[model samples]
Target: MSKILIIEDDLSIGEMMTMYLYEEGYEVKRAENGTQGEQIFQTFIPDVVVLDIMLPDIDGMKLCSIFRTGSTVPILMVSAKSEVTDRVRGLQTGADDYLCKPFSMREFAARIQALLRRSQSFPTPVHETPAGHPIRLDFEKRCLYVNNKVVETTFSEFEIMRLFWQNEGRVYSREELLNKVRGFDTYVTERAIDVHIANLRKKIEADPKDPKHIKTVWGVGYKFLPDPSLS
Candidate 1:
């Protein structure tokens, strides 16, 4: 059974979600505050997290970043704020998905399902770049190695790299990249993709200022060049 950790301050809502998720055959745990949530997260090691933005102690955004530092466990941020900026910030902070307040339990369940599916389907055999290439991708391990050095990457960054690597030389618009990375159900602005790409280049490119692997196609979008010499 998939484990789900719900970090919600609202007791009624938290209990409601827990009950529904249990009915869905998931092992569920709830934390009333961010501090407790963090503790449970370390021990429970849930498959997915349901986090509310308005926590009594640590806020959801900060908690999300903290979780990103060590694990790529999918996080679904729930917030009463429906502003575009809030949603973008949540995604940029490493959340896999976001749900605004006043949401249906059914929709909530569906969002969780999508995140779980995406996480579970990510692993495969290691993929090595052409001989002498500086980059290596271990899909099963979800680790990126550049010049034989392991590079730390956020979940979004890794997903973007995975897609670009699989379809090298294919240009993808910011919107297309957003949909491909975060799923069609998410509605974040395209600009978030730019931020993720920029962060990714910093880790993989010799110089993020003039990226060699991910190149901008003026008037269109961005494409990955497996062979940096071609850039």
Candidate 2:
């Protein structure tokens, strides 16, 4: 079973989220403050974290940066600040996804489910690539490394990178990638796939704007070019 940690200062909101998550059969841990939340995070080592931006200590953004420095576990940030800058700042701080306050429990649950599904979805191993960049994908550990340094990625980004690594030269359309990576009935749009690819490129490519690994096919789709010299 997947474990979830909720770090919310408000007791009522924390309890409500706990109740709903419990109903979904997830192992839930609640922390009312940042100090306690950080402690629980070390011990519980949850699969996902539901973080509130307004915390008693160590605000969500700081906590997110701390977490990002060590692990790749998915983080869903929740706050009353719904402005574009708030969302962008949360993402920049390393939160995988952000949800404004008063969010529907249904959408919250769906986001959690999708994140968990993507994190657990890994394909069989493929042949090795010729030496080039110092990028490495460890299928056994489900980790990515750039120049031997750990690289953090969201669940969807990881899935997309794994697919591209496995296929190497095969081109994948947005619809095809959605079906292959997220599966059907997931409610993810083609544009979401583009977003995932974009995020993955930022982490994997030497230059995201001029991606060497994930190349856009313009009118067709996207393909992974393993050989840096070829393309």
Candidate 3:
């Protein structure tokens, strides 16, 4: 059974979700605050985490960043704040998916299911760039290496990098990139894609101000250039 950890201070909501998830045949654990959430996270080692944004202790964004530092576990961030900036910030902070409050139980369950599917579907083994290339991708490890040094990347960043690296020079609109990385069902603004792309450039480009690997297509979207010098 897939293990699911829910860190939510709202008792009623947390219990409701736990009951539904249990019926769905998942092993579920709930934490009421970020401190407890952190403790449970280490012991439980959940496959997917459903985290609430507002906690009495540490906030969800900080917890998400903490979880992301050491694990690739998919995070589904829930927040009552539905502003575009809030959603974009959550994605930028390393959440794989986000849902606003007062959401339906069915959609919540579906979102969890999608996360589980995506997490399980990653290809195994390492993938390397062509010889003389500066980038290397380890799919099995879900890590990126530049110039033989490991570069810290969030889950979303790694996925975007993997897509761009595999399909060099192909322009992907923000909408297309969002769908490809976060799944079509995930309701996020296309601007979030721009945020992710910008973050990736910071990690991979020699100079983020003048990016060489990931380039903006202007009037469209962005594309990757394996060998920017040749382009």
Candidate 4:
């Protein structure tokens, strides 16, 4: 009985999704524009958001970016724009999942369920790097802390860090990181992954030039090594 917010300008689509989600046993809220959507998001506090990209008041990308600044709620972006750039932009801006228009209802429902599952699974799991001075990831709050100071993170950045923190010593190629984080359906490039990793290093590492937590694996890929002593 999770709550859901549908922020879509199209009345027909919004009503239809509301009805469908109601039938699926979810408490649903609806808003037709970004301003109203933002208000409802703060008040209703939904578990997941079904956001349309082309809103009248504010665009979905802007709204998503705003939401990411405060909350870690899963944002599933929906749009008619099927271009790879559009998809990548949506993901880069902090949408947890992006779905092109004309998507099947079954897949839509499944994606919502998956996002909710991921969001609600961790109650109080705190992952820490194995060093004298460690980086801590608070799963419940979707927060990253270095030296006990909060470090702001985008949704995609948080996911990548979570993957690495969860599997401390495992190597992940650029392709694998893209597929695992942004999903296989999205057209995310290796460069995007590199950019995300670079940004993360800047936030957590004292020196981005020589990263300690996330290390390069020669030509293969990158791995997260917990113990700073191993660096």
Candidate of highest TM-score: 3
Per-candidate Cα lDDT values, in order, are: 0.87, 0.80, 0.88, 0.83
Candidate 4 per-residue lDDT over residues 1-231, each given as its tens digit: 899999999998888888988999999999999999999999999999999999998989999989988887788899999887898788778777778888777778887886776555555677654566668888877899989889888666888888898887898999898777755444346766876788788889989999888898978788887676765
Question: Ranking by lDDT, best first?
Answer: 3, 1, 4, 2
Error of 1 at 69 (Å): 1.5
What TM-score fits each model? Answer: 0.90, 0.80, 0.94, 0.83
Better of 1 and 3 by lDDT: 3
Model 3 stretches astray by more than 4 angstroms: none
In model 4, which runs have C-alpha deviations exceeding 4 angstroms? 128-131, 154-156, 174-199, 207-210, 218-220
Write model 1 residue lDDT over 1-231, tens digit each, in one string: 999999999989999999999999999999999999999999999999999999999979999989988987878899899998898788778886779989899989988887777667775978998889999899999999999998877766888899998999999998888777766646555767887887788888999999888999987899999896776
lDDT of 2 by residue, 1-231 (tens): 999999999989899999999999999999999999999999999999999999987889999888887787888889999887787677667676778889889988987887777777655564344566667787766678777777877655667778888778888989888777655443324655666777778887889999887899987789988676776
For candidate 3, the TM-score is 0.94
Task: Using TM-score as the measure, name the better of candidate 1 and candidate 2.
Answer: 1
Pull out the clashing pairs in model 3. none
